[model samples]
Target: MSTMSAKIVHISIDRDWREVYGYASRPQNMPFWASGLAFGLMQDGDDWIAEGTLGAARVRFTPHNDFGVIDHRVTLGSGLQVHNSLRIVPNGDGCEVMFTLLRLPGMTEEQFAADAAHVLRDLKTLKELMER
Candidate 1:
């Protein structure tokens, strides 16, 4: 299988890993940090309907687990689906939250870089919120 290019943007939070995962994994709290879902997400059965990022999209999040995995898939209105891998891992006395951003099909280097920047900003926002 072909592998897509990726960037893992992450931030360290001075909080427990489980606590960070619990707060961050909730859909209701996404808008506060995840700019793409800043407009908010509406529950639609098993998936959530979001109106941010690139127009309207449907997002499917992973089921809650003891492991700090919050992977999700976003399907755009155009049917382009993107998979995001997010994790909260113990780091020192706190935890590290990481987001893997994959370079989607037809994505230019400039676009990929911009996406990475956006993810970094989001992670920073998460760190700030969690540390507060």
Candidate 2:
């Protein structure tokens, strides 16, 4: 397995960083910030399971706080297992978001890095959306 991490600093939105993060953390609110992403809720034992499209990838969200741990299984192409944890923190007049993704067995380091960049870009896009 391989590990990849990204940090996005200074997302200067007017709202409180915690609140903004909380908004993003919700499964129902994903499409608002993520633009094209779609999600559906299902019951999985005692926990709520969120199945959704994150860009071209199929992602599953397990509940957390203003942060989340995502289990992503790629569809329509190569099979990749991605486990990710996300956090948003206050930084100066803005906020900083940190993402850590661990690539499960069978995925290469290069693929993990490439996917990490994509994830960061998505965060940047979401930040822009929140700021505007």
Candidate 3:
């Protein structure tokens, strides 16, 4: 598969990487930081259902791991699937949470930029919640 344009949006959290990962990796905890899922998610089998602007999306999160990987795949109501790569890695006394935003096919420059901004906002929210 050809690589698409991608941007790594990240934020530093003043907390242990393991602690950050433990809280952030759970699908049930996402509504606190991920604005799109403000109403929270409902478990449907192994995938989670989150209602967004476009409609319900089926999100499948990666299994728990020691490497701090919290990747997920989202299948929108329209059947458009977006794979997200997220990670929490140690940075001295704190940690860095990173999200890889990819420019999908037919995405305009403005839309891609908006998506990056959205991801950044979510990460910032996570930082705030963890630091408090």
lDDT per model vs. reference: 0.93, 0.56, 0.93
Q: What digit string (tens of lDDT, one per residue) describes model 3 on residues 4-76?
A: 9999999999999999999999988999999988878999999999997557899999999999999999999
Q: Residues 1-132, candidate 2: write the lDDT tens digits.
A: 334344332234555677667777765666555433545444455334444543344455555653423333333224454455566777665677666555545557887777667666667777776777
Q: Select the stronger candidate by TM-score from 1 and 3.
A: 1
Tell me the tens digit of each residue's lDDT in model 1 across 57-83: 999999999989999999999998889
lDDT score, candidate 3, position 15: 97
Q: Rank the candidates by TM-score, best first.
A: 1, 3, 2
Which is better, 1 or 2, measured by TM-score? 1
Report the number of clashing residue pairs per model.
0, 0, 0
Q: Model 1, which residues run further than 4 Å from truth? A: none
Reference-based lDDT, residue 51, model 2: 44
Candidate 2 stretches with Cα past 4 Å from truth are 1-15, 34-46, 50-83
